[model samples]
Each structure stands twice: as structure tokens, then as C-alpha cells.
Target: MTGNTDVVVIGGGYAGVMAANRLTQRDDVTVTLINPRPTFVERIRLQQLVGGSDDAVVDYPDVLGEAVRLVVDSVIGIDAAGRSVTLATGATVGYDYLIYAVGSGSADPGVPGAAEFAYPIASLEEAQRLRPVVDAAPTTALVTVVGAGPTGIETAAELAEKGRTVTLVCGEVLGPYLHLKGRRSVAKRLAKLGVTVLEGPDAQVTAVTRDAVQLSGGRELRSTVTIWTAGFGVPDLAARSGLSTDALGRLLTDETLTSVDDMRITAAGDSAAPSDLPFRMSCQAATRIGAHAADTVLARIAVEQPRPINLGFFGQCISLGRRAGIFQFASKDDTANRFYLGGRPGAKLKEFVCKHTLKHLADEARKPGSLTWVKDDERRESLRAKRGEAPATAERAA
Candidate 1:
């Protein structure tokens, strides 16, 4: 054992768990993972949890490899130069390398009263608290969902199906990422499920309150419950650590997923910005980035050359209600290239993808760094060769 040569992973989300388990595969390194919660929260399925799904969470022990050490504590900050992290409990842990996978949270809409009155379905705890309030409200209670993105759409559809008068308010078109056909299909399903979608120019929400939501044009929507899922903002942990981060609080990393300031610290999932490629804030990217981050760390520890990230997001799968959804097919880069399936068939495919994502994690946890795909040195070399010498740009020209 490489005594004290431990990899410390921050956060217990998908990316963090995958990296820890992958690092544990090497006998030369010890993996210590720090997280605030004992169990890993399936953030993608938080909407399902709000819809009363009990299978949205997995116990950490059941999903983490035995070789990985789990510490339940919140990371307060990181001392990147000193190779240590300070915890909320006033304790410090040293590490040879670090992986930052502290995921994102719901973006607070800048509208007045929104923060105080709106409930966001971003975390498990938040969703759990929302369930009871929703379940107890009158069957005809009005529930307005701000933002017509996947999260907002799913929450509105689920609540509408539960007999609530749900309205989805969006400043732009519904499913802005979806093609016209897919968007129409989603709208159809929402209407059929008794969901009212207020989109287009007048869809802007100006304020939220306990009784109703006010739109930009002074239109008042009487609502008993208000949900805000307009956007997401990753925590400023990277900025806090004095690392290079984007305006959105995402750590700026190279294609190799290593922080620009220090290669010893890496980032993945929603918290990582891979140089220039647009990394979508979704589970598909999270899973692939997690695997790649692990590969990057393992390569460094095993003294093998690191692998380049080659992620291909097949599509976007969102559950509209209990039995309907829209599957917007896309290229490896997630640019909605086409639309393959929608409605029930699309919903089934979405379910399959979610199951496969968790199963991949489960398999990795059981084997502890046994993914054979990481050893493809040829692919890594080819990617590096393609990313050949950076041409003289205006910035470099100076």
C-alpha cells in the first residue's frame, strides 16, 4: 500500500462515488470520500421522489465499494496548495489528489418574493418536504411551476396527474432544447394530463407568493403551491478554493478534467467545465464525466498516461408524467440533432436509461475500479494527437 497516498473525493454524488471506487481499484492508493450525507442522493430522480417514488435514493454503503472509505462531513473549503481540505466540523483531511464533484443547486430566480415563497425540487430533502404539502392540498389546488425546462415540466405534469391544477410558466418556448415536433408532443401530453402551459412572450414570472404567482404583464396566477426550476447554479466551491472557475461557478478544467491551477485537483459532473465543450447539467454528462475523472486519477496513480474524455450523450430523456415523455435524440455533443421517440415509447426508453445509469454505478461499486474501458491508450493518444499544438491565437500572439 502507498501509505498516506490517499485520494480524497469531495461530495458523494454520482461523479464522486465513481471516482472514489475507480481509485480504490489500485492497491497503491487509498480512497477517502467526504460527503455531508450518509446516502447518495439521486438528484436526477428528485422530481420522481416528489411524485412519491421511493426508489430515488440509494444507501451509500450499498453503492460504494468496500475499499473506499466514506466520511460524512461537509467540506468547508480546500487548501489546494497544501493538499488538504477543511471540513465544516473544523477538521482537516490531507490528500495526495482531490476530485471536486460537489454538484449544483436550483438557481434562485431573481424575481422578488420568489426565494421566500417558492419551493425548489432540486434536492431530496426539498422534494420530500414538497410531497406532503402537495399531497395534502385540495385536489383542485392551483400549482404553478416556473420555467418550462425538463424539471419544471416533469413536476407540473406529475402534479397535474395527481389531480392538481398545475400551470407551467416559461419565459420562452416549452422544452427550448427540444425540436418543434418533440415540444409539440410534450405539450400534447401535458394538456392531456390536465397541465396548463403558459409559454411564449407572456410566460415570464415576476414574483411568487404563498397564494399566487405574478407574471411580467401583471397577470396574476392564483396558486396554492409554487415550484421554481428555471435553472441551476453550481456551488462556488471552486471559486472559494481560488481555482479557475467560470461565471457560473463551474471549475475551468482542461480536456483531461484537471484544474488549470493545479493538476492535483480535478473536477467532474456539473461542477466541471471541460475547457470549451459545453457540458450540459444532466445525468448523462455526469455519469460519463465521473468515469473519465476516475480514469484521469487512476492513470496518474498507476503511473499510466491519462485518458482523454470522449463522452457522447445519445439524447435527452425526460418523464412527462407517470406514463408519458419526450426523448429528444442528439449527437455525442448533445446538440438536439433529431427526435426519435415520444409519448409512451419514449417514456419506456427513458426508464431504461435511468435504470442502466444506476446499474452501471452499482457494478462499479461492486468491482471497485474494474471498468476495462479505461485502459484504451490508443484512444487517448489519438485524442491527444488531434488536440495537437494550440495554434497561435491573438491572445498567444501577444
Candidate 2:
């Protein structure tokens, strides 16, 4: 345990960068970040990218620590017993520890014709592909954004602001995570932007064609372009590598973020299911989980017992357009409260959050182990009780 510890982190999203940067805190530890892209994609800004406002990318030198080695490759398989990873380059990389941070992607819509017709903005490539498509379409083209989550709402608002006829089809409820007051604010803003908001069971999309979408109540809406953002699914790398995973393909881990199947392996971000209870897939959760995952690996390398995770939520910020947004406040457990900031102020706050996310990674790169977060004691206790474990000591750290 005294010589050196080599940790290979898969995926180069917010979580992967944070973990790699934080691991540099120890001089004895070497961190290698494996990713498919050389630059970091600000996933939260993909809507702006499609709207022709921003490019939604950052250089690796701006966010990743100088000490962290960057490997531009994809991990095809994980060899748990041999403690190595098989990369797409047909090379094997040995590691003392592995951090599974492969993020989530657009879920299969499952509806007929959806796979062939609908465009998704879940990743950078998808957003890039859709940008040109939107630019070439006529301004009056009928655009339909399926799903009512943050991604769907933001995409609808962005396109509507650009003078495209947009229809938001809420599968169940618009902003299902939003409180009543927050939802109302979004509804009003979307209405002002000339976006048609469709809610209720009848609004659910049953199927999609090349130029139209069919609703559940035997209704068909003419759509020149359809954008699907209903659900998210994680990569199957963990399952394919013979690691234990939840039903959704997220790596199963304990409260300490260590994989339940192998102590040498840990997980973070959207692809991690800690105690079978994964946090909501968002940048707000990803960065914190990434920091925690690094700390777990560092503790293990030092021959010290790692502490359990103690994460809390602040709120959800949804951008309506360039000029308006909604910052829905939440409790420690991430349940929306009645209070919110809407309109121009909310828009400014949302902009600040986006900038701060990038600033966070840059700061962590300069000052290793600088990021910190709040802890939800109640949620932690509930999870421990469900596992029939003893009460954990109240110890909180970055």
C-alpha cells in the first residue's frame, strides 16, 4: 500500500473528470481517465447547442488535472479477476482500482416508428446532428418534442424561441418532479413563448411517423420533426463485464460507492446504483458522486476504512428560453418545495449554475479535493435501515 496506486476511471463526463481531478490529491496515486472524446461536453447546455446559441463543449486542459492521464479510448470489457480493462483499441490496461462512471443515454422509446423518426438530444453527437436538421427546416415547420422532463421542456422552449412551431407532449405530467407552483410558472412561460403544452393521458405519444405523431386518444398531430426525451438508460458495460448491476444496468455499489461484487471497483454518476437506490440522473448529483467515488478509492489505497456516502440535493433548474427559466427549490432529499424563482431572475440563476458547473471542474483541477457538498441525514438513515445495518456515525467531508 505504500508504493503507488493506479486508478483507471471510465467515462469522461462530469463525474469522470471530477473523480480523476480529485484523485490527484494524493501524490502516491495515479489517475487515468478513459473517454471516447478528447473534449468535455457540457451536457446541460446541449439544448443551447441545438438552439444555435452555444457549442456546449470544453477543452480537457481546462477541466482535467495535469496529473491525471487522459486516454482517448472506449472500454469494451472489464476483467474483474485479472484487474484489467479491455479497450476498443485492442489493448488491455491494468489497474489497482476502477471507477465506473459511464453515464446515461436516451432510452428506447419502444413505440413503433419512434426508433426511425425521432431525434434525441441526450448526447453531444445527437445534439450536433439535430442542429443542422433544425437549421435547414422552415421556421414555420411543426416541431413536436415528446416527453415533459427537463430535457424535453428546455428543448421545446429553445426551439420555440427560435420561431419554430413546437408542441410539448407530456407523457404523464409536465415537469413531474416540479412542485405545483413551479409547474405553473413553466406552463405560463411556455405559453408566452408560443409553445403548445399537451398534458394528461391523452397527450402521450403512442407512435411516431416520418412527419407526424399519433397520440393515445386516437389523435394524430402533424410534426415535421419529432424530438424524443422521455426516459434515460445507462450503458451495459458493467453487466457485459460480468459485474453485478441493477435492473437498469447501473453498477450496484454499497453506501461507500464500492461495488458490491468487488471491493477494488467503485461507481459514480448516473450509472451507479448505491444500495439499489440510485440518485436522480443530473449534473447536480453526478459531480458530488464523482468526488465521493474518488475519496473511497483514496481511502482504500491508504489502508483506511472508507466512510459511507452522505449526499443531499439543492434544487432543479430548468431553462425555459434565453430570457426566462425556473429554479425550483427542493428539500434535502430532492423533493420540490413550493418556493421557486421564475422569469428573468430564474434565467440568470440558471445561467450562473451552468457556468458554475464548468468552474467547479476547473477549480478541482487546480485545487485537488476542493469540491464539497451537503449531506442528507434522513435519507442516509432510511437507506441504512432498509439494508438492516447499524446507524452510521455522522461524519461528513468533501
Candidate 3:
């Protein structure tokens, strides 16, 4: 609506960068992205970062639009009413609209000694911190990777391939999101890597120590390094700022990604809880949501109706070192199918996905709205059905 329109994006992850780049479509819109780090973090490759195979940091100019002003500062608080964000450096930056894309970090383990002993590989700093510690440990040292998520599996494989003795303690099942067929493929690869895969309820970790990790079954294993890769948790910025959020502190928003409490604020990435049901916390969902978030703001500026988010996940891909991987195919809704590409082919595909993700930001940075993703009308309706709402009901709510 105005050349002076100011949009500040908090977080420079995939979602924030995507939003910031797409916002450049409107020359009148001034976009400023505030992040704690100067380089872009490739979160999907954090395991590789820990393994020292990749650095996981990209220059801001590589992914961010040239028009975007990069503010290397953390947002301590958001004054929604005043339309300003307080930075950690004791400075306040005003904004006409704000996008919350802080993404996520490893959730609290809630087990004894976990916080003190286990290292999480969620953030770039965490991975950097773990890399040195992992390198210092003897090759014979027992490396226990807790949780069965993609992060845990990838980390376990990454370390094991480096000649480190590794053990993967799955709380219940390895790759719980993967279909049985896909799970078997991953298990076979881990086995080939000499990674001890522990499953079942008894495999659930109940405690951790500097030298050992205790399971729920009363089994204690000697572990020199414990890597925690459990659930993900969002920043408390939304809650602390007195904004409406879900129980996990993700900013609650409607289908249009607009905060329920303030129309001027929107959320994207792992930090967003749309209709109290967040999509899986991954770059797959983050980039799409980020583009939609920017589109929502653009729609508002144009005085047009903003459309609801339409997202469809393709499937899951877990790299078993750099040599092999398991890429499970699925419906648009994300449930794994019986078919999948395993071994070297899957590894190549997984590598392509990671590279293309960065290319997406760069492409959008140059072309603004050049990015596109798959979507299904049936999938959208099913999501609303789960919320026990009709199409008209969701429309009015939005």
C-alpha cells in the first residue's frame, strides 16, 4: 500500500529467508530480517556438521535477497501493540508487519542428567559444540544416540561411519514416521555401518550421565558421548511477549498465518501453530509456509483476500552416511507408502533435495515468487475435518 511499508522477519532460517526474499516482489515493501547469526544454517545437514562432513553455514548473500536488510541481533521481545521488536542489544526496531520464524530447537529431554550430559544437534551452535567433543572422544568410545527421529538416525549413522562405536536407542521404533518397509531399509543400512540399533519400549532412555545412559528397562550402557535428538521445541518469544500461543509456545495463527490476537503479526516455520495443528517441523514445511506467510502480507498490502495455506509433504528421507539413504514415497498427506528408493539411488536423491532447498531460496531471492510446491485439495479438506470444522467454518475463522 505504501513505499514506506516496513516488514521485519525474526529468524533467518529457511522460512525467514524465504519470506524475506519473496517480500522483495513488492518494491515498495522494505524487509529487514533479524537473526542471531550472520550465516544461514542448513538445519537438515546438522548431522553432517557434527560429523565434520559439512560446515552447515552459508553466507547470507547466497540465500537472502539483496534488498533484505540483515540485522545480526536477536529479538528479545515483541511489542505488538507498538509495532516494535526489542533486540538483545537493548535496541528497538519498529515494523509495519512482523513475521515470526524462529524455527525450533531440541526439546527438553525431561530425563535426569540429560541437560547436563547429552549434546543436542538441533541448532548450528549446538552442532558446532558437539563436533569438538565428538572429535576428542576415542574411536572406541560408546556414542549413544537417543530418540528414533530422523535427526537421531542420521547422527548415529554419521558418527558410526566416522569409525566411532555407535548405538541408537530408539524410544519405541526406529523411524517411527517411516513405514515398516522403509524402517527395515534404514535398519539394514545402520547395521552395515556397525551401528547398534536398540528398539522397543525398554530402549527408551530414562536417564543420562557423563559415562553412561540408563534405559527404562533398567539397562545401563557405557556411553562416552550422548547425543540427544528427541522432540523439537519452539522459542518462548511469543508467550513472553504476551501473545497468544499454543501449549508448546508456538504462535497460534489461522489458516492465513495471521496471529489470532494481532492482524499485523504472522508466523511461519516450526514456530507456527496453524489452527492448533502444526505441520511436521522440517524445512519441507518451513519453505512453503514461509512463502505463504509473505504472500499473506502482500495480500494485505494489496487490499485483497489472502488465501489459506496449502501444503503437502512428499515423504521422508534419511541419509545413512553419504553412501546410502532411504527415501520413502508417500501421498500428499505424508503417510509413507510401501514403495521407496533405497541405497545409492536414495542417497543421491536425498543429496539433491538438500541442495535444491538452498537453490529455492536463491531462486526466490532473484525471482521473488518463482518457488512452488505440491498441494492437494483433498488433503486440505481432511485437515479441516480433523479439526471438526467445515469449509465455510474455516473460511469465516480465517
What's the lDDT of the predicted structure labeled candidate 3? 0.93
Model 2 TM-score on a 0 to 1 scale: 0.97
Per-residue alpha-carbon lDDT of model 2 for 145-224, expressed as tens digits? 99899999999999999999999999778999999999999999999999999999889888999999999988999999
Q: Give model 1's clash tally.
A: 0
Q: What is the TM-score of each candidate against the true structure?
A: 0.91, 0.97, 0.97
lDDT by residue for model 1 (48-100), tens: 88777654788887778898889999998999989999999999999988999
Per residue, candidate 3 scores C-alpha lDDT tens digits across 48-130 of 99998999999999999999999999999999999999999999999999999999998998999999999998999999999
Q: What is the C-alpha RMSD of each candidate to the true structure, in Å?
A: 4.3, 3.2, 2.6
Off by over 4 Å in 3: 389-398
- Whole-model Cα lDDT of every candidate shown, in order: 0.81, 0.94, 0.93
Ranked candidates (lDDT, high to low) = 2, 3, 1
**Which ten-residue region of model 1 has the weakest summed lDDT?**
373-382
Candidate 1 — what's its lDDT?
0.81
